[model samples]
Target: MRIFVWLFRAFIFFALFAFALNNSQEATVRWFFGHEWRAPMVIIVLLAFGCGAALGVLAMVPAWWKHRRVAQRGGDIAPAVSDAPTPTEVQTPSGVRDGL
Candidate 1:
């Protein structure tokens, strides 16, 4: 399964590589802030993908750091729940008897 996944990834990488190589038309991208940047269409696509990935990782950093800190502190901050019930004497219900 792992080998199949790796092969699939490799195939996709090569396919994208070939596509970028074949399509190298220069294009200009207009930013929302009135800035225009020119680059190959493939470069722009790859840059947008890279920026999205970077932003995703950046957004996760704070949560990851908090989890790491909690884990490093021996996980003492988490609440503990007991699975066992409290010790109490059981009483037979009315109209129920033993050896019936």
Candidate 2:
């Protein structure tokens, strides 16, 4: 399984490499104040993808911090669940029938 995963990753890497090579044309990015930046199309796309990934990680920072804090305090990180309750042991609230 690990070998297959590695092979898959290598295949994807080569595919992306070939795509980048084929799309080496210069592309322009216009900014405010009539400014423009130019770079290879592949480079621009890769940069945008990287920036988006970074931003996505940044967006999760607060949730990660909350989890870290809970873990540091040794609080209940998981919701309550006992091993496995038998049908008879599981309780049903009033006005609800167990259909026994």
Candidate 1 residue 20 Cα shift, in angstroms, is 0.7
lDDT of 1 by residue, 2-66 (tens): 99999999999999999999879999998898999999999999988999999999999998998
After superposing candidate 2 on the true structure, give the runs of residues whose Cα lies further than 4 Å from its correct spot.
78-100
Candidate 1 Cα lDDT to native: 0.90
The stretch of ten residues in a row with the least summed lDDT in candidate 1 is 82-91
Q: Tell me the alpha-carbon RMSD of every candidate.
A: 4.9, 4.6
The TM-score of candidate 2 is: 0.74
- Which residue pairs does candidate 1 place in steric collision? none
Best by lDDT: 2
Residue by residue across 1-100, what tens digits does model 2's lDDT show? 9999999999999999999999999999999999999999999999999999999999999999999999999997788887798888988888888566
Tell me how many residue pairs clash in candidate 2: 0
Window of ten residues with lowest summed lDDT in model 2 = 91-100
